[model samples]
Target chain A: MTAGGHTLQLFEQRFGALRRARRTESIMLFVILVLLFAVSAVWTDFSPTQILAGLPRIGEYFEKLFSIQPGRDTPPVAVLSWAHVLGGIKEPQSIAYWFYRLDVYAALLWQTVQMAILATVLGYSTAFALSFSAARTLTANRTVVFLTRRLLEVLRTIPQVVLAFIFVWPFGIGPLAGILAIAIHTTGALGKLFSELNENADLRPVEGIKSAGGSWLAQMRYGVVPQMLPGFLSYGLLRFEINVRSSTIIGFVGAGGVGQELKRVIGFNIYEEVSAICILILLIVIAIDLLSARLRHRLIGAL
Target chain B: MSASVTRHLPKIPLERRTLHWGIGAGAFAYFVYLLWLFDFDRIFTGLPKLWVIVRLMIDWTLFAEWDHAELIHSMAETVAMAFLGTFLATVLALPLGFMGARNIVPSPVFRFMTRRLFDGCRGLDQFIWALVFVRAVGLGPIAGILAIMVAETGILAKLFAEAIENIDTKQVDGIRSTGAGRLAELRFGVVPQILPVMISQALYSIESNSREATILGLVGAGGIGLRLSERIQINAWDQVAYVIVLILITVAAIDSLSKWLRLRLIGGPAARG
Candidate 1:
């Protein structure tokens, strides 16, 4: 065979073989994934039959959650205007009408945000202190490192809700219990993140400080903390975002906040009140997210 | 001499550090005040009870005769709930991700609306979603899964869309040069570019959802949570401790596994952590 022809033929053969191999690999992967999902579905009792039966109930629930609408049989207003679109504040169909308890909602929202702020501030500070030892490159005493890390892990592993549940016993059912619960959980979480940042820190400064006979505290304050502060603060901010959401949930178990109120409204089947409280909570969370994002950007820029 | 002095004298002099120290001191004082106001007396009185609770939680001897099979089952259920919810979230998010991507959808209105919808979904905390789902589905892992699925979908879509928008559009142009249809171009180009990110995001979601799901049981949405709550309520400290142990192990294992996979697939260690 001509050399050109032989090279072309070889290229085709190799390309075909590669394509076939890829196809088989993908097919096998697909099969395995399908099998896994199937088994998981069965275990979770998420069968199609169950979903179909449950879906309408979900629709009904949402129907109640949505602000009251004009009855299907109600006659159309003769005129359309912006004012008409906004159901009257006292009108049952208006969103504002549903949330008429705005003062109560606002107070609860403020309390919830306070809980998150306090918890995050306290937690991140503790995390900042603990992270030095938690960093593998920094700690001189292995025992201290081991103990600190284990402590953080245990703090993180237990749910904040559970901790709050326990704390309620000592502090009584109030924001204090909620704050402590979230703070402990935050310490574990932020410590891990902070330590990772510490681990990744530029060590030259630390080594420089050490060679000059710097004290352990001096090494951290001058050498490690500066490099990691921005990252730590960023993570702390993110944790605050998460804690804000969690503090809302912890309230349901009598830890105190808007969530306690939310739990009450939900239990009584007062769907409109639930919707109002929910809307308020949603707005607070979004505001926090936007504010935090802006703050992080500015902080990083400054650093 | 300057460098030596720098090392000898900490970077910030004591006088200069006063402001920083003051902030810290103020925070500490505020915390103490809060604690004091919150019935600090109760804590001192409660210390004895706290020790008993801690001892109960730490003592494995009490867990020896606990129902091992049930504990194992609930642990499995927790993992399964995380897995199932994450899977559904990823599946539900993928299409919306495409719609939300500004590069993909040229219409600003559509893109804006899609993003707003995502923000709205994430704004409501997952606990509320769980409560809503429990009401809807009548209490089970299915409700937990659905709640997680709904709650995560918007956030995942937002992440996925951002990843899509950042990809090198040159690849899509290269695929287009071959006379491929839009769908084919996207299939051959966009999907591959986004696959690594999508997988990592999904895996990360499952890890986080696992933590969140552990508590969904508190809302009766299904997981080991209901059992945990039950144990806590009934003062079955041993069982509660055992369940807590199981959760810690599972969470740590999954976390390491996901990190490893992300590192392997993405070709980088967690340097940014």
Candidate 2:
């Protein structure tokens, strides 16, 4: 009984030492994180005092957004009512009054959707063409893979907004510039995703095609394409959803979309209109998300 | 042998073949219509001006005269904003994550509300948030930080909740067998399992947020984007090129560093190898 107790004591001692070491490590990690946080807060000028001051202003901004402002020859209306929401544009408090330029915004939003679609198509095609070369598992030439990967990296690393900013200089301020910018970024992003998927693809079919004396292109066509098609389509649809968001914001750089209208309303301090446009954008985004999610679910389920 | 092989091949139904052709033709027609609508002719017209900008960027004349210090400072500010924002979001998300997780919350109604709250936060783009916050707080990195914090909180919370939901229930059951209270059970059981995942996700957010924070300055929420937009406005292609290069390097560096840290913390395949 004493011997057994002695061994138990030794085991407890070792376990206790291990626990102490782990505790110290965790404490050290916590200290380091805290230090980093403090430094970052100082560097960014982030303070509780600043936030406290800003909180009221943020609330005020929201209030201004929701409340109706006086239009030319109209009275300011403070409270929101269902009647006001469903009333005509002549009423200052009306949703119709706030979204008076719905036709224009709608056209711009359509253009945004078109830009997203065109960019997605363009990016998807290019990414599909390049992915085979970029994938390490498929491509034999290291140099080709290396160069393609680097190119994709450069394309992906540059933010779509920045790319749109540059394209605006060359392509001029329109949806075309936005399309090119978004397409290029999408190519990079989707190329990486596609190549990764390709790398993970089952390769037995590829070997079988090779044994049949298929050329590299033929092998890829018959062996890999069938397996990767669903994944590509799924990712392409996902990219379309993301591209819609990108196309919306690319307008901020004068690349064409409802974003320019948003920037205009915000710049002019048309608070009600800002909220109106935000509501529209939010609804559209949610709709696209749901639709694409359903489509993706079906695609995966079919697989 | 060739004739016999051809005879053995299964023929596609006529209706299926027609459907395929119709789809192909329809897609082609639609693509053509969109091209015309978008005025594809502009590419040919715009090529000369595009070449001019590209050449000017490549030339990099007066490269030494560029304001390197200001560029570096803005880049640092961007990184700082991302770091601070992500840290704060992670802190705020920990509890929200628990509240949202299905296994933890138990109340489907509460979980649904929490998830919808996350969706609302995430629905608006970070740029939109930055724009609003800029107006609210006045122009600075502070606005950028808040925007990032709000957006990242939603994202990190959702991710953390998913991670928590996927945890091994057996471990939680074991901890419960010790007669520990709810908080104790969570601290010992749930937190330990999901801590690594939470840290990794937060680290990834920090990396992406760094890239995002660069552009928050376009709305006057301070960062390198302000400088970039200023240069673009002034038609300074050479300086723009330099800034783009710097951004690429900084983003890449952050990405690799975050990856390394994640691997070290999480013990991935590389670590195991």
Candidate 3:
């Protein structure tokens, strides 16, 4: 064959091989994924039959949640009406009756919010202090940076609920346990994020401070803290939103919050009360999310 | 000289300084109130108990005596639930994502409703969903998996929809110019562009879901959380410490594995970004 013909043939051969390789690689990945799914499905006992069997029960549970049960004198109701929803607590089908313990729930919800706020503030402060030490660019001592990073990592790696479970023992089953758990977890998470912000901060200011014979603390405060303060606050606000959700549930371990009430109602199978509390939690979470998002937007805008 | 320096200095605003002090004092007051409300005195009283638990955990004398098989199995179950949940959610989210994407659907009302549905699904925490499912499904890894699936479907769908909306329209146009149909255009143009993002997001979810799955068992969803809680209930501090360490290792392992897979599949600094 002519040299030109040979070159063309070789190019085609190489292209075909490349395509074949790509196809095989994708096929291999697909097979591996399928195998993994099969194994996980078996291990988790995820059966379609089970889901199908449970579907009606799930429907019934939800139906029960929407309808109010008959009181000692009231007749059984099949469905809720607008009138019933807006009716007095004496009306068995009324939402007010469904949420008869509103005052208790409200107080617990408030405590949940307070826990979130306190945890956020405490965590933010602690993380802010540790972040400088954790940041390689800010900390001159490598050992300090390494140790601080590891400490933060360990703090965050354990789930907050598990931390709360442990804390319940120490703190005796109250919001204090929950708050401390959330605070420590937040500290770890925020510390890592803050250190990253510190690492990315403008080094010129730090250099200027150092050249002026400033100490490490002075350099960090004058140089890095101001630059990253907005980011820190933004993250802190976001964390508060997350902590609200966490604190709401941290009571599952008896670490004070509305979650404890939720777990109780759930345990006792008080379907209407369960739905009411869930709705309340949802509203609070959404409200906090909106507020925090607005705050963060304004903060970023100002900066 | 002092008078000259004073004259050269800029005048600070009085109200601004007062505002700063006011905010500071108000925050401090709130903090103090919260401290009192949460019963700050408990810390001192709790110190001894905390120390004892801490010491017991660190002792490690009976570490090998603990139930290794059961703990390891529970840990594996947590990982499996996370993987299965994330996998199923990713599968379900793809279609929902297309429906939710503005460019794909072209109907504002439908997209609005879909977005709201996503919001509703996301509004509840995974733990709460786990509790609900535990009640529904009667407590097992299935409950945990379903909970993760429901919660992650919402999150992944939202991310996928955003990814779909952000796709390069020129590619779709190019495919359409080649006499390709709508489905063909999507297959050739859209899917290719968004697959990497979807995979990355799914992998990220898996990492987080593993952490979450560990706790789902607390609500009777089945995982290491059940074991940990059981141990805690029995005051088995040594066993609890073992379970916690195992969880930390498993989570860290999964995190790195997912990171590596993302890097391998995406193939660049873009993966890290």
DockQ of each: 0.58, 0.72, 0.80
Clash-forming residue pairs, model 3: none
Model 3 ranges with Cα > 4 A deviation:
A1-12, A66-77, A80-91, A94-97, B1-9, B268-273
Tens digits of per-residue lDDT, candidate 2, B1-273, equal 669978999999999999999999999898888889888899998889989998888877798888999999999999999999899899999999999999999999999999988887787789998988988888999999999989889888999999999999998899899998999889988998898888788889999999898889988998899999999889899888899999999999999999988987788542210
Q: Between which residue pairs do clashes occur in model 2?
A: none
Sort the candidates on DockQ, descending order.
3, 2, 1
Candidate RMSDs in Å, in order, are 4.5, 2.8, 2.8
CAPRI grade, predicted model 3: high
lDDT of 3 by residue, A1-303 (tens): 699999999999998997787788778989999999999888878899887877788888767755754686775457657886788888764677778889999999999999999999999999999999998887779988899999999999989999998888878889999999999999999999999999999999999989989898899998998899899999999999999999999999999999999999999988878988988998999999999999999999998
Q: Which parts of model 2 have CA positions greater than 4 angstroms off?
A: A66-77, A80-91, A94-97, B1-7, B268-273
* A268: Cα error in model 1, Å: 1.1
Per-residue lDDT value at A244 in model 1: 88
The docking quality of candidate 1, as DockQ, is 0.58
The superposed Cα distance between candidate 3 and the true structure at residue A253, in angstroms, equals 0.7
Local error of candidate 3 at B208, Å? 0.8
TM-score of each: 0.89, 0.93, 0.94
